[model samples]
Target: MATPQPRRWIPYPPLISVCASLWWLSAAAASVHEFPTDGTVIELDDASFERAISAFDLILVDFYAPWCGHCKRLAPELDKAAQVLAQLNDPITIAKINADKYTKHAAKYEIDGYPTMKLFMHGVPMEYTGPRNAELLVRFLKKFVAPDISFLESDSAVQNFIDMAGANFPVFIGFGLNESVILELAHEYKKKAWFSVAKDFSEEIMVAYDFDKVPALVSLHPKYNEQSVFYGPFEGEFLEDFIRQNQLPLTVPINSETLKLVKDDERKIVLTIVEDELDENSLKLVRILRSAATANRDLIFGYVGVKQWGEFVDAFDISKRSKLPKLLVWDGKEEYHIVVGSEYLDDNDQGSQISRFLEEYREGKTIKREMDGPSLIGFINSLISIRTVYLIVFIVAVLMVIQNFSQTEENPQFRGIQDGAEGTDASTSHIESCRDYQPVNKED
Candidate 1:
């Protein structure tokens, strides 16, 4: 009888099973991510790169070469930004991999240039085209982590939101409007601009933003001190178009980054080429361009300085010998148009000159010309300049001349024939050189 009772075994307690399940969940969560949280820049190799990408919700990876000057400059800035970001409740990791050493990974990411910053969000890679400075970089990266559309319930909340948004991105505040109105656009353009809804705000807020009505969407370009208000009809493409156009400032400084932004835009660029963008005169001219841009939102007004980006300026057939402050309307591609009468701005009255230039551009009184050299290949951080192309051609011509001279020395009859056909052959070679290097006038 005792042996039969012993055969009936007892079950484990229910609490034990509950405890076991909790333990398993905790272990799984820890195993999901073992990333460093000490604000240090994670140096990733091919082995750990995939693990890091999967571990962090948001991470910025800099694909860089050790020998690259730009990469060197970016390192300290990244280090500082990493420290600041680490203090956040939801931190973003800054990482770098030597693209030069990791050939396989570099090729995989199509890392054609050094210091290529890519932000990986939930295993999806997006090119990081934000500012490089530590402070601005932090503000820029914060955009990614921010809510699709922040809801402001108070005036101070609205002001604080604006202050924290920084001047790097355009801020769109929907005053007295429903979240559903801007929810879609907020998600669509989250990366390019900041979107928000002010649930409770007074006329002070309205007047400050220069809007007199409720249900008004205000787009603020803080960096440019510009604000534009949109009153409804915000259902379809009108809302989207307004957001798209206002993403850029009234006048954009034409640089590698800004150029990339304008490339896909349908509007032609009213480009002002100056000697030095940082100069007093150039800055004054930019103000005038901004005013014109405000009035003519259909066209994009941009300026480039020869001192800053000589190659890009040269692409427009501009040189130091040419007049400064040259104005043209570019198709944002291979061709640009110059008003025949207003090719250059007057030093005495730049504002009037710019107005006339815009008028001429609108009236189709302009000459279209192709960009010099190749079709803007690799315009971002271009290694080969127009001058470099010209030098290579010049070298080739010199080598050809040397070869011909050597051939003539060996063959006396060939030299005699060459001399006899001098005018015809010389003219042909000269014309060919001009054709190769000169800007093609499409208007011709």
Candidate 2:
């Protein structure tokens, strides 16, 4: 009929159809997901999990257990984060599932530990290894909702981008540079860092980021109050290497989340084990570690708190009896080195101790030791410390010995036999003979 009606031709039927299809798609997209406006962590179960994941463009789901202390600590932070994130134009949903209760769902996602976070973007899942503090977590999650490479037309836009980027993740801004230059990197490292191009920015902005050249790419670690500028050669591995190295701050705190970052890095870790990472002494030591890290950019300087993660500390053979603020160079695997002379750091001379340790490490003057046990499993399942495990074994052995002795005493024949064996001088004679016999050295 349309062909026959060609004489009364309908102009641009395809264009009309395409316009109608686009309108339908836009409506469908709007209807497919209705983001929550409540700004509270949505409690999810097996039944609603899939629906929720498909309903939001970006969602951070915490796979948690009811009795998990870490999960409990994370709840309030998540709550605060939900409130802040919900207000964004493209809201990010914060949700949790009791992995313990919903074993099927947990197994599907490979959630082996408590409070494991996974971010779902358009139905694809990736592990969420960002900061846990409420404000920092908000900043970290914002990266997902942001454009891969933001184009800033004005200086005000640059300032707004930086202010909005926050301090959780490093931000890269290309000044007087083209988007095509950093496009690939922006997409590659988008999850770990923020990347943008400042189309219009003044020298004052350059001074703020500590760069003096045009067509410069500046990397900012606002959390650590650090910034570095790279001039040109932004085509290949050189640009990537610079960006990769700067993903983490000069010194990173070793935790479950940050540990993921450290593991991905090729550099060895200059690990400092402290009594409490939040304590004043530990903070001061972290600053020293940062200085060392600055000097030796090839190595990652990290610190973990014994109080915060005792099992991890135990893996390094550190205990309450051991010296405080222990320094070791970890290969980020099973083996680590303790400098022979500078094994333990003195609180008074921590800076010197760290310098000496690093010096000895470079000079190959250190003792290499395997971690006490498999640290990942130990971190998750070791509710009690290694010392506690030993103590329990000791107590059980002592109790078994006492019970065996009581049983032997109750058995008259066994007691008489034991007494006879104890009274025998034959055992004593054998011991004396063995002591008198010297071990003969054999010729190779």
Candidate 3:
């Protein structure tokens, strides 16, 4: 929804350096001592053509005619863009190639548009294209120039976002970074969920959205505008409330109201058997479940644990009338849907039991799968954080050092044989008569 404004009239001297390739080496050397001061502009011509393009990793080619109104409007924008990109230390050489003078090269490129900001990687055209505004131009050029992919890919990344988060209808494209997968998954059940959400990272959109320290998720709801989100990490009731509203096809959390439904109502209930200590693997599984449940409705969740009981009760407010680690598909009159903790559905659903649960919830069939590998995979992935894996490596290095030191202390190879060999100490015992005779002759 952003539009390019008319660029202010800026002069071209700052943008038109005579021998830019020669100046760049000096500039790069100085930039290390100081900061990136200013951007160098090279005017490209047919004379030293091939050599100029090779000077930089990325090149922002501006093919413009001085007479055109749009070209004039875009000039100042390009200047501002050069300054911003300089701050990022992007190695894109900004060349204002005179398309008018170099008609052959322009025609070779199939010049269909005016003021086209095409990002060429080694002379071949690629995406990272946009209109003439400096901000947008900087964003377009960043992917090729900057090493880290911190900038947003505009609305183009939406499809991938859906795939990444396992989202469906009414996707939220981070209106203000509301991406926490669990809360968004939870909120989709409330009402007729519609509308998607997304973030507006004035510039650095992708970094802000990566599965980084900032909580992130791409969610979809059944209804177009009824989608929901949790921008930051959530815990206890905030998460439960969001999930409950979404009408997730998974188990409804066990609590006082849920207990009443099992006792006095006609509907069924399904509860996940949470262990005493809810580890990250279990937590990730819950989030993934929340995502898959978007396609289903009717099933409820339950939790049973004496150790983290307070957390469970506070999260969902359940009573401890019947405490069994079971996934009870409670049909109205009596407990009907019972998948015992000891028994598990087999191999076919190694990683997709949550999906199976949703399918069963909607289609009135039971689906259970043993989630061992995926569970362990998730556990490994969780533990493979920056610090934890490094800690393991550190411990291994220390143990190896200790083992080497222990071997060295047990064997001091002074002549190769440590204990039973003929050493210098053993030879000293045989030199008795020769030494005594020499001392006696001298005295005599």
Candidate 4:
């Protein structure tokens, strides 16, 4: 049998381009996220709005008044819908006529209620009426909106969705009606589920399913896009069960909170993101934390490996890592005093940087850090080794040294003087007498 030959080297000119391309690839591989919400909103008269409605998949019109109670309730719902639409990239054209402000627009739609939704297809009204919940409206609008269900697209592609999915399909969308705790658990495995975080909500989707409460999860189906949705606010175990029930593969998103939790409160935060479950990346971050914690006992050190939503993974909407392990001089919403690698972490002169971060934390600054490098995981096991104990011993030793030095420095002749110099009895000094002396004052 012929021995296998080594592969030929890459050509020169091509290699140069390849190097450049590699550089570009490395830059791109840094994981820049794209948000799901994308689109423009407008508040205009019907005449001006009708022109652009044709291009949009769904043109949702809201008829309302500034003073109506029903309208006020509908306001939050519609705003939520707009936000969801924005996230979906479906781009809803919301024309709010304060029946009193745009009587012409309101009158043209023949609006009876203070709040109403008209779903238009091709610039012509196909389905109309509101007083509906957000999910229902979202569900109802799906028929008209293309479900964009081409799985060939990266799972990262979530700008907009129109599918029977939710409960019926392969995906899950969580709503605000769900509890924060549930969301927190969902967050734990957030990469596993697609969540829609909302502060307010509408019953459109709920009434459609006759279920209430949020942080709801709606499963989706590609064909039944219009009516597909499972209700939820699935928390830790329950959410986990649902995933298992569906036989969904577990997606390990970077558990920002959990990773931060694993750290000793005194450690700094370290963040990392990689293409796979490679230990090289994991060890890189762990080592950095190990070193920093070793150097300074005051740091609240931690390391996060971003698989998804665990803090370092690129978020589709915000397109950034939210939390990482690094000493926090301050508490930022998504930031901290960062240390990128051993180069930055192992600096002998971290005095200014460390102090600044502490001061920042005092002022309640928060930080989300993303860091990389080899030296990161090197010394994690020796973190903050007996630092408190050592500090106490060092202080006591310095005090003792000072006391002994003062005793030895004293001269026999000057001993009395030294005692009298700082002594409580001033009379012992030669300069002063124990008896008081009277002094004459002209005023007396």
**Which candidate number maximizes TM-score?**
1
Clashes of each: 0, 0, 38, 78
| Deviation of model 2 at 342, angstroms | 4.2
- List TM-score per model, in order: 0.79, 0.71, 0.29, 0.26
Ranked by TM-score, top first: 1, 2, 3, 4
Give me the displacement of residue 195 in model 4, in angstroms. Answer: 25
> Residue 314 deviation, candidate 2, in Å?
2.9
- Compared with the true structure, model 4 gives a TM-score of 0.26
lDDT winner, 1 or 2: 1
Rate residue 267 of model 1 by lDDT: 84
Instruction: Give the per-residue lDDT of model 1 (tens digit) for 168-236.
Output: 899999998888988998999998899999999887888788999888999998988888999978789
Across residues 230-314, which tens digit of lDDT does each residue of candidate 2 receive? 8969889899988988998888888766777898899999888888999987888888888888789889988899889887788
Candidate 1 structure, TM-score to reference: 0.79
- Candidate 4 lDDT over 1-444, as tens digits, reads 999999998779987999999998776444221111243335555455544454454567666667667778777666666666666545554445455576675566665555555766666774353225767666545434443222212222332333332432245444444345344544444423333433443556456533476545555333323212345434555555454333221121224223332331333332323333346644554444444444443333433334433223332111234323233231212333432232123334444544455455545454344333323332221222233346778999999999988886775667777666777765455345534555779699
Candidate 3 lDDT, 235-346, residue by residue in tens: 6666545444443324334443344433443334445555442676455545554554443344444444445544432222223654423333544332244333322323
Error of 1 at 33 (Å): 4.1
What residue runs in model 2 are displaced by over 4 Å at the alpha carbon?
Answer: 1-48, 64-87, 95-98, 131-137, 274-285, 305-310, 320-326, 342-356, 374-378, 382-444
Instruction: Tell me model 3's lDDT, rounded to 2 decimals.
Output: 0.49
